[model samples]
Target: MPTIVHTIRRGWVYSPFTCEYCGHEDQGAIHMKVGASAQVGILQDYDDTRDLAMGTAHGNMEQAGDELIALSPCPACGKRDELAVKSFYAKAKPWIGSGALFLVVGLAGAGYLASEGEPEMGLLATSPLLLIGLVVLIAGLGKRLRKLPPSAVFRSRNPEPWAHLGPERASQ
Candidate 1:
């Protein structure tokens, strides 16, 4: 059996928020891009994670217990609360957009051929490729819409290196 491997570029997005009670500004929500691949892999190993941490840390920072401290106490308020996730989403642009484009182009070419009176040839030429593209597009969109990162994403109470927290937590 041959081992299969591929490269994927992924990331987490965080937005700033303010505490209404104490006029404190901090990261309000963390938006992570999640999908099927995320279910079985680790996100912390990616270089993007290092950059994300650099943006949030202030001083004397270090990785503790294989996890980065993405969230910290508000400078003024001194309260360590979980920030809300603005949205749970995944990047499907590559697959969905490309797949749709392929479908359109293939159909257009087929239509042109049919207009030229070779209807049979047109269908034969474009059907397979169009079908493949359509399947890829749907799969991509489904992964993006359904698989989502969670706000309570923590392992051993540590920030996940890739920030792909985990499954959603039960509401209390």
Candidate 2:
């Protein structure tokens, strides 16, 4: 029986960002690790595992680093800004506007049909659209109203690192 060997790759992404509130510059880092396994005797398979692990580590590091930079507080001020929360609501504004439009149209159409003496038909035709619009509108509003306190921001032990890994310097 061939023994299986596991290979692991580790990587980190570092980003330089300015504090939204205090205008202080800082560096943020996110670390990631990935592993893959292959039979001990298969050299080619081991190489494939290394490739897989490196790729996974790279992708994860990038995504995690972005999130960290966005949500982490400034090391100098120890406070987080509302930029991320504001951006989130800005992105949802279009969806909320569309949902409101759909809801109004559905209601008007249903009312018009009912006035023409086809109440049941009108309700049956517009019910699905009305329901979908209501759901989307509520969800968008809920997200917009969600609050993020200062404590909610990520507080890393070492938000500013002296040295970090860059994309070109990633090790396999």
Which structure among the candidates has the greatest lDDT?
2
Q: Give one digit per residue, the lDDT tens place, for model 2 in 15-76.
A: 66677888886556655455655554655566665566566656666765565566666778
Candidate 1 least-lDDT 10 residues? 58-67
- Model 1 residue 39 CA deviation (Å) reads 24
Model 2 stretches astray by more than 4 angstroms: 1-12, 31-64, 146-172
Write down the TM-score for model 2. 0.58
Q: What is the lDDT of residue 61 in candidate 2?
A: 60
lDDT of 1 by residue, 111-172 (tens): 99999999899989999879988998998788677733323223323344334444452110
lDDT (CA) per prediction: 0.49, 0.66
In candidate 1, position 119 carries an lDDT of: 88
lDDT of 2 at 41: 60
